[model samples]
Target: MTQTFDPPPPDVVLDPEREASLRTIGVISYALHAVVAIGALLPGVQASIVLLIVAVIVDLVKRDEAVGTWQATHFSWRLRSVLWCGILYVVTIPLWFLFVIPGWIAWCLISIWFLYRIVRGWLAMNDRRPMPR
Candidate 1:
């Protein structure tokens, strides 16, 4: 879906509460991203899909609050990122046993792509820059 975000006006002034909420969202986003990244590397906490669902819930809930702001862009990007990871994983399911080598390669590539997405978005947020459309 082509999502639309209305960023607050350039001259818009945020109240303390709104600022705090934005910060909270950023931290939560990072935590969610970190969980998936770490989970992939560590077998014990391999609940990426579940964790992503929680994160998506947070994103959906706060998305409206970020209307017209960079945070909206983040929510949009992250939701898609998680889904892409899920897609990649699902696509490799059949190949996992029949084509073990290719499946492993695909998994590794997906992991790298996932990490890139998370890190790229995190860095952009740190710089207070808007996510790409």
Candidate 2:
């Protein structure tokens, strides 16, 4: 019997240049997130908010181009991570006024969560896999 093979679907195939560009963008974005995450985990190191803002802006502007691609999930994932972390930190602000220890604990937990997300997303990107929705 003769062997038969079928080509992958169009969506599963990506242009080489386009894929390279997307990967480059993903690397830059992940790098920015890692820096901020590292800073949050350290007591004295402070990552600039500007780095995050820049990352967000780059993601927003390039996200549309990544539509219909696996990289799209990464863009959304990073954005959602930032949004959720910001909201959680803001919501916990009252804890600072009421109890300093609780506030510190809450922030530490949030920071750990933020770092986890960054590391997970970065690893997924490096593996060339799509992030879970």
User: Using TM-score as the measure, which candidate wins?
Assistant: 2
- Candidate 2 lDDT over 1-133, as tens digits, reads 5533233347666899999999999999989988998898799999999999999999999998888788888898899999999999999999999999999999999989998998999998898888877
Per lDDT, the best of the predicted structures is: 2
Residue 104, model 1, lDDT: 76
Per-model CA lDDT versus the true structure: 0.78, 0.89
Clashing pairs in 2: none
Q: Tell how far residue 130 is off in model 1, in angstroms.
A: 0.8
Candidate 2 wrongly placed segments (more than 4 Å): 1-9
* Tens-place lDDT digits, model 1, residues 1-133: 6745456688767778996788688768768877777677554667556776788898888888877776778888888888888898998988788998898788878877887888888887887776776
For model 2, give the 10-residue run with minimal summed lDDT: 1-10
- The alpha-carbon deviation from the true structure for residue 65 of candidate 1, after best TM-score superposition, in angstroms, is 0.5
